[model samples]
Target: MSASIAARNIAGVVLLGLGLAVGSTGAPAVAATTVHTGVATQLGPCPTPTEAPGTEPIPFPLTSSVKPTDTSTSTVIVPDGPQMQCSTTAPTLYEDITYSSPTTGGVETDLKLDLQIPDTPGDKPLVIYITGGGFITADKSANLGQRTYVADQGYAVASIEYRTQLTGATYEDGLADVKSAVRYLRAHADEYGIDASQVAVWGQSAGGYLAAMAGATNGIKRFDIGENLNQSSSVQAVVDEFGASDLAGMADDYDAATQTAYMAPGSFINNYVFGPGSTRTVATDARANRAANPATYLRRGVSAPVVMLHGDQDQIVSPSQTLTYLNALKAKGVEGTRYVVQGANHGDMSFLGDPDAGLLWSTQKVMDVITGFLDQKIGS
Candidate 1:
């Protein structure tokens, strides 16, 4: 059979099997399936959940393993699940902690962050959450549920509000704010009972891009800006969900037809990176683009291990972006892993909106991968 026909048959079989499985359970099955672009292989078995450090039992639907079929293809599966939920204890919040930034007139327009520590005692690792809004719009509380859940998992979580293009902030300004947040956390670790050494940055979409950049360029002097220059802004690991790694390659990822169809006015690539006046200049400018790329900072010794999760069918940020970044990490011998959610789309809503069975199944898988990765790389 032709490649296209063969793929169709495989998809049919997988969907049929999923339907039957879901029908028995009376839960909606997520119509998500792994889409293969090249030669296909037998579907791999779902990974076994890895045990996390700490007394708590590891969460369900965990991604036990991640295997890349080639540079471009891979499969990720989560076992059936018990739904994930946040902790009952309210977080001890340190609201709107301001940090000085040169970009915003020093102290007059200082950037702010909201630190949320679980009520549970002891010094815990810190995870800074960055929200996604195409670098144009976002608030610190964008992903409250996930951040709260992570805090409940015994980590200090900080939901950060950074400058955006709308506020005259460039990518450089955003990175500076993120680094400043890290420094602030470390400086105040004692007060919050946080283990400053075991810090992690987690973000989705635009925030994912920042997290990746922060993790890749840890300890690099140029990206470190704002107050607390004496303290370090380094993180132990990164969790990037569908973040754009290489800005230059984003427009290039689409073909003539795709680009024509999707590249509308005020696109994230255009407004955020290039600024308001020019069209396509930022996308074409090698120097500016390189400065913004997470891949540009990657080297043998500078990077932290990364765990990335992206939907195979994501139209906003192509899956190839993650693949390319992963390849760069591998080339430098930096530890990194990726989970491509089959038939998944751009955001959490896509995963959460799946059929009842698919929602629980996918959620468990996502939590498992993230928690497992955190356990292995940064502990707890």
Candidate 2:
């Protein structure tokens, strides 16, 4: 049989195999699907930030993401193959880090961050990075190679993790975790050994979504926390790599099989973060979920500079998703810097070849854009 026919046959079996009957091919098939299922379990919820208007800037106790009681469960996953290690010989710098948040009840989560500070750090600024895996998988360790490469360019780098495994099933919950993480970094400025005011955010996939939302919604009236944390969490720049920006819009465009994966277990973002009763619907549990969408949040104002990178042939998150967001930003006079990695698929490791080519091409340019923004904002 042909590839399309083989796909159809396999799809039919998978659906029927999962207790779903094969629908008739007589009528036209629509991409939009209605999911009737129970909850998708993943990480627990992150605490909410309370607005504290007219109150003095409280010196909140800080928390570091690293914990003494915690144990290392797994080493970094080398992208090319099994034997290749990510970051061993690369130089590493240390910084005393801590953050405090009302969500954690003012008790800091013992955060000990390792900085990959370059030799020439006076002019170079930092990019506070968060890695992505549907907001459940991956961590600071897995990004060792990427961090090491970016650090070689004279930029100070910090890899961070917030209350991980969040109920990212909704925008409100996911963004709340992001907000708290940024606030934590700001709260412990002196400890991290960098100017907190000059920080820019960057991430891959879902992390990209969080970074985009942080910059897009910064200082907005809707998502503000009435505390000093609110002011500190604001980002001066952002770099988003093929993340889903518009939840409702993306859901409306998702292919059948991807939607199936989404409706399945362990697909945290789709299963728990969105779906039936979430904010994507008007009659869902709370308005905060739908309002959590970054696409809906984009508007004219003091918008921060942004650099977006995506693979033109990305099968997971469509290119249209990035285009829609970039268009919206440009319409508002934001004019974000963009580069579509030609023929590249989502998260492919091919771009990392040719070490002599340097870090100004491919996705590495993302870190460069961030470094330039920080130079303009902080180093100036």
Candidate 3:
């Protein structure tokens, strides 16, 4: 197809993704495919349960895995449900905290945090995880089990939620939510018994993108328009797993599946960083958007260390993107790490759902890197 026709097709895909960025709107119901084993389907109230006349019955136990209860804080009670247990050990501390940011019209985004501590008695490290949905679909609840696993490893884990561009939300707005989240954690580090100086950021897919951006430029300078424009919420380390590092990179033509995913309803990578039309300037200086890209952000400074994770078979975010991103980091002489899950798909827990590929890296592996990186940078 002609470049113009291709761009128009991509636009159609992006628009579709904007619609599906948020989770199901109406009341929860069973689906043909269950989420996992422990997670529950969060349903809102809807008038009618839509189903086709010839459709099969929706399956029961529709969630993936349930999250363990948060009983560390007397004030915080773990919501009752089936939860996945990552490790044999249980966490010793827990806290349920919420903070509001005026970044996006004073809208208060919520965060579900679990603070895990080690028995040895040294400085505690922190890792804030942003779940992936290309900046639109994921919520804190979807990752409770994974956060608990990381917490059991003895690092404070904060599962963050940010505003996405799916519904026309701006990158400035989403970054503001993230910046606000960092500030909130830093401002109340004592409450969670954490050493604010040892904080790190990690995320999967879109979350990885957010983690990179938050750590890339650092502070309000990352997002052009936020109220405390000079505030800084820098982290000690960063972990980006199959995240989109370059917006302009996405404008290139992709296969149907990748194109669909790149343009899915909740995905706003293009809109958030590159603005509306493919030709629109995403930032004040068109270069600013590129400058905001993680690849371009590598420079001489005490910026957070980085670790990138991706699957070679990922049709979503191309492998070339990760290589290019890593190349930029290497040219700068910055210390970074990478792990290519040999045959896995983009962010899918398994290698095309295979068990014998021997390259099936789970969220736990990602957590290990985060923990290891924090230990090296800040010490456990």
Candidate 4:
């Protein structure tokens, strides 16, 4: 028996979880705690629609001869549907609240967020969720129902709207909008029952890129302009789900057809990101993308802990993007984790354990990966 090993378990796995540090072996830094029900598939906190036909195997002594009967005529059959009420503690939603009003794309529009605060009182960590729409339509409400999983974890989940190309927003403007949302939350923390000091950013695709940039550029004065000057726009954690990392090199990861499409003049990826319309040249466009890269700002201490998740089946932003981002993280000595969800596509909620949704991965597993990391980082 070794005395040094005696302090810890000798037979089980030993993990050195420093925030979101993925080991060199590339396993998930945080393994979710699974609760096994009697059924094989229901290893989550909530009950799924499946239960392998329950039966009382061991019969009790005949205290009373009982027989089941349908006593109520009110029982009615409904059409086939996949929705199941998982929790009674519904979050308090504050919808379409104006956070910032910036004139982007020549249109001065009020950017808003739909905040979901848990039913439990007291302060909780705020997760600023940024939606992805390829920078063409960054809607605040897309996949909003999927966000409830994050909110149900006793955290305030704010789905924010950032200005996109539709609003004539450049990558810089979009980043500013995301950061401004953070400052707004801090300035009005008391009203929302949020622990402003403990804040995180979670985004998908383009939103993911912005979220990563926000986390990587913490303490920098450039993007901290606009609302709530008194408060800092720094976030403690970041979750980049299938986001574009290195914009300049991203085209290289695409297939020949996609690369051609991406490089085509006036392409939305070109027009919205780098060069506008026919004005885009390869050199100038790549320069703009390089400027928007989070790696440009990532520093060891300045960047928040980040956990980048990607689906292996993602066709839009190739899975290699996560690796590219992770390489940048390693170069800066920043703490980062990489998690690839098998059978999961891009940011499509349709595949989240619903027959209509395609049932790629159980929603419980996804939320556990996301909220679990948030819990480790800034969870109250």
Which residue runs of candidate 3 sit more than 4 Å off their true CA positions?
A: 1-85, 92-96, 103-123, 219-232, 251-267, 274-292, 349-359, 363-367
Q: Write model 1 residue lDDT over 1-380, tens digit each, in one string.
A: 22321222211111111110000112111121222121222332221113211111111121111222233444464434554565556566666666544544233354566676766667888888887766765466455556655666788888777777666667777787788878877877787789988999988878888899999998898887657777898889999987888766653443454343224334446556666555654445678778778887887767889988876544446667788888888988888888787655455432222333234323656777877777776765
Task: Tell me how far the alpha carbon of residue 38 in candidate 1 is from the true structure, in angstroms, after superposition.
Answer: 51
What candidate 2 gets wrong by more than 4 Å, as runs, is 1-91, 95-114, 121-124, 164-170, 221-231, 251-254, 260-267, 272-290, 348-380
What is the C-alpha local distance difference test score of each model? Answer: 0.63, 0.47, 0.51, 0.64
Candidate 2 per-residue lDDT, tens place, 1-380, comes to 22321222222211100000011112121111222121223322211113211111111111111111111221111122122122223334454343222233233343333455554434345676766654544344435555655555455566655443332224444455455556554554454345666767777776777788888887764443323343456677887776776654443334555544443433344433553233333224235445555655665656667777765444445555566677768877774766565444445322222222212223333444445555665553
Assess the local accuracy of residue 330 in candidate 1 as a C-alpha lDDT between 0 and 100. Answer: 90
The 10-residue segment of model 2 with minimum total lDDT is 13-22
Give the candidate number with the greatest lDDT.
Answer: 4
Order of models, best lDDT first: 4, 1, 3, 2
Pairs of residues at least 3 apart in sequence or in different chains that clash in candidate 1: 61-364, 62-368
C-alpha TM-scores of all predictions: 0.74, 0.60, 0.65, 0.74
Give the Cα error of residue 63 in candidate 2, in Å. Answer: 40
lDDT by residue for model 4 (1-380), tens:
22211222112121111000000111111111331211222213432222211111111111111112121211112212343223556566677777877765456776777787877768989999887766666656555455666776788888887876655667778888888889888877887789989999988878788899999999998776576767888899999987887764455544454555555666555655653445673435666767778888888887998988776545456667777888789889988888776544454432222233223323555556677899999976
lDDT score, candidate 1: 0.63
Q: How close is candidate 2 to the true structure, as a TM-score?
A: 0.60
